[model samples]
Target: MTPLDKIRNFSIIAHIDHGKSTLADRLIQRTGGLSEREMSAQVLDNMDIEKERGITIKAQTVRLEWKGHVLNLMDTPGHVDFAYEVSRSLAACEGALLVVDAAQGVEAQTLANVYQSIEHDHEIIPVINKIDLPSAEPEKVKTEIEEIIGLDASNAVLSSAKSGIGIDEVLDAIVERIPAPKGDPDAPLKAMLVDSWYDPYLGVVILVRVIDGTIRKGQQVKFMATGTTHLIDRVGAFTPKLENLPDLGPGEIGFITAQIKEVAQARVGDTLTDAKKPAAEPLPGFKEVQPVVFCGLFPVDAADFEKLRESISKLRLNDASFSFEMETSAALGFGFRCGFLGLLHLEIIQERLMREYDLDLITTAPSVVYQIELTHGGGHIDLHNPADMPEPNKIETISEPWIQAVIYVPDEYLGSILKLCQDRRGIQQNLTYVGGRAQATYELPLNEVVFDFYDRLKSLSKGYASFDYEQIGYREGDLVKMGILVNEEPVDALSMIVHRSTAETRGRGMVERLKELIPRHMFKIPIQAAIGGKVIARETISALRKDVTAKCYGGDATRKRKLLDKQKKGKAKMREYGSVSIPQEAFIAALRMGDDA
Candidate 1:
């Protein structure tokens, strides 16, 4: 049995693009976890989307041997959307390697993740990475870390992950500084399943951190949360690749493949214990994740409904955060209303469906849940879709979800950032400065930032700012549902709920954007944005006119005038009887309006 003192289970935590994956690659190379010929950039990032985007979407674990110590390294996603996954990764580790880019210093996500690690009570080893870059400012970043995060930076390791500089020191720090795992191997089996995925042949494969006792092949294990039992078909460790192991003892990170068919059966945070002699109680701190943002996902083709459903089930095997239910839109047809952790999470899932499943999807604008109290009665209902909202007269009060957003930016752009936040009706919570950089906190409506706030903030700050947010419950706001009409017919897919103050501006923008997107048809089309029954803004697309004068060759001026009059009358008749077909591109344009600018 591997001695508990020789085991060090830890994760690398950092903001996105701060060299977490690169440093993980260096560590894997240094420890001979993967041979020199087999090493590649972002070795821990397994998905094609992850590699292309240069970000980790899912947390991955690997076992390494360094100086007789069994070091299990977990690489976690850095984006705010996957913060919950990062938290789960931190729970399995005894320590964390906090990586910061020397050039970028500290950002919003870095601070958020640092606080998460601290909450987990994990020993943190600060590392200043990318020292080889000409813009590297290790000393400056170290000072920032010390001043902002309140961690000692004098001993922080300085390294260039790309150049393999100071990697030895990082490995040494893990061996000497991080505490080893401690648990009783002789006790009843207890393991926390940190991650899980479905396999075609082996069925559900669960990645677990064995907290107590032992888990072995052929033993029956019970999932405490689901109360399901299955005989373990195989037990293995990821030495960069899955290799069979006879048993996994306490403090070891490995995988257990049973005949469990459904991925939900082996949920993350669920406890796995020996069925014959289960632990007296399950592990502590198991909380199910709830999705915050929701949108409708429908296939462009009606026949692809089954295909979309099957694809969703397959994707659900890998991602457990997203939830979906059958929803039908009058315009969009049959689809599912899917919920996500955040916008980025929603985008990733959509991209996966398109790339992996070869699906063409039309996704509605994302929305947050609102609580609406009935004036007629005293009861309230949660409204996720604007189409499902009760009549305005029936609502006593409507409360929209709000979030506490923290932004880190240069002091110079403070005014612009604050203005942008105020435009979104954000309330200033506090503001402070750290090392010439400003940290601004605001309580903003979640709907405001859910769509294009991040893109706008980055553009305003010239990409020098970073932001993170957490839901702060709901608050009463003067909100109204804005509807879009094409040729005086309301388009249900283009309806959105917005604040009263900016309703006109938003509506005007949508109408103008739609005018540019919709192609000129045989009949004039009027694109109008209306709140309730009143039109707030309108734009018109002129009809495509065919020159009747062109056919009057060698004719008199009177003949040409008569032909023009005849054409005008025909166009008027066609305009009254013909219906304009709005193209799919127009809908897409409306969905992405204000996002580009």
Candidate 2:
């Protein structure tokens, strides 16, 4: 098998909105992946939220041609939440296009991704994008990159993906900076499954990079998992254009359509090869991703519980990022508590679960790992799901997870930002001025930032600040229990833990907000607060049955359940004992109250 003489493997990696997708649009247009008449910005990011949020969530690959060589170009999710997917994208490539914003310099995520690329030994080519903006300062950013990353940023090419200025240099830089895939074409099969897509009509479409050997149509190949064998239904490559080929040799990526009975057989890191000739041992150094954010996913209708479980299983087959287990809820009926990487990851998984699989889901508030003690043992441990939490007085110390956050803002807003972060229990680490902008780094609990932190920061900064962080180790901090009561009785469902310093102010505001979000009930809904089993404050939720029993329509007298559900949406029910029914929305309001308080 001759080397295709025409193929380069590289991917663009960057922080969100650092112009990776915009640069990809420009690169594809100039390199013949798409023509000017066919161009649209952020084409690789086709998801609705990706378009709305202006960030890439899934890794997308496209074919591009330049200087007589075909470049298998890839654009990957840049946010910290999807870092595992980013890692897989990097492992499949030989080089990376590290894009940085001209005005913002190197962000926290930029460094994290750059390190992920380096771990895979990717040849990194730095590109400064957004040079077209009025505040663009490529020179200052170049120095920041050099000092922070120790990269030769002085030689970094400045380009405006929007204006198409100096775009050619970036392409030339990739060819010169990135290495070509090399291997013995005549060797036995060993291809890396880099990416995958599903077509409801076509089953699963597999994307593979031929590290070595060849795969041909009608040949028997065994998927690493399931040991299931299938005929290579078809073989094809893209010269920025789909071209049918009998077979693909070393250094090329092509699509394969196999009779994949299940997605379990077509995982991203799985290897594909001739049945008799397997790789030395599925390429080393790949790890399964673990979820960091946990939440309960209940169906609005209890009858949909099994259907929700089935949908989650089907979704997990296609998405290696999401994880779940069948669970039962006294209030939520039968449901599943799912875990994700973070807020963005949770949003994508939830949206895709509903939109793609078509399930009506009611999600509980997202939470981080909570250290709990077992009543039976002297040992302490970590709990990612609330369902796993032990009964209230299991003997010992408990701590919530924490993170180290770095926020960047303009110099003028430094004072206000500092005050705001401090109110959230952030321990200021350092403050610095980079390229004339102020950056404040702090160590804060992951729980503190889980709700409305982004919204609060934007409101304070007039929408000019950006922040990112990773889970730092946790330490036992001053803790307090926040109890939300209905009719002056504490409801276990609405109880939450908080920093002790914030109990009175933050806790009161939280329970009060719950009073508003929880629906009016058959009886009056009173949202109250308690500390150590003693009620401290109270707020009332109006009673339901708005028009009373006299206003029922002629045929609608039997629709009591429908009316109850709708009415309960705004209220809580106080029971005869110390029990209360806290509506689902109240569960969410308790978390968000900290933002304003």
Using TM-score as the measure, the top candidate is 1
**Candidate 2 RMSD computed on C-alpha atoms after optimal superposition onto the true structure:** 7.6
lDDT of 2 by residue, 196-246 (tens): 766576577788878788889888877664466778887886544556788
Candidate 2: residue 44 Cα off by (Å): 1.2
In the order shown, the candidates' Cα RMSDs to the true structure are 2.7, 7.6
> TM-score for every candidate vs. truth?
0.94, 0.82
List residue ranges in candidate 1 displaced over 4 A: 301-303, 544-576, 595-597
- The reply for model 2, stretches above 4 Å from the true place, is 1-6, 35-38, 218-231, 238-244, 261-265, 271-274, 299-314, 326-335, 352-361, 378-384, 419-430, 472-483, 488-492, 499-505, 517-526, 530-591
Give every collision pair in model 2: 518-570, 518-571, 519-570, 519-571, 520-570, 520-571
- For model 1, residues 321-387, the per-residue Cα lDDT tens digits are 8899999976778999999999999999999999999999999999998889889686999888888
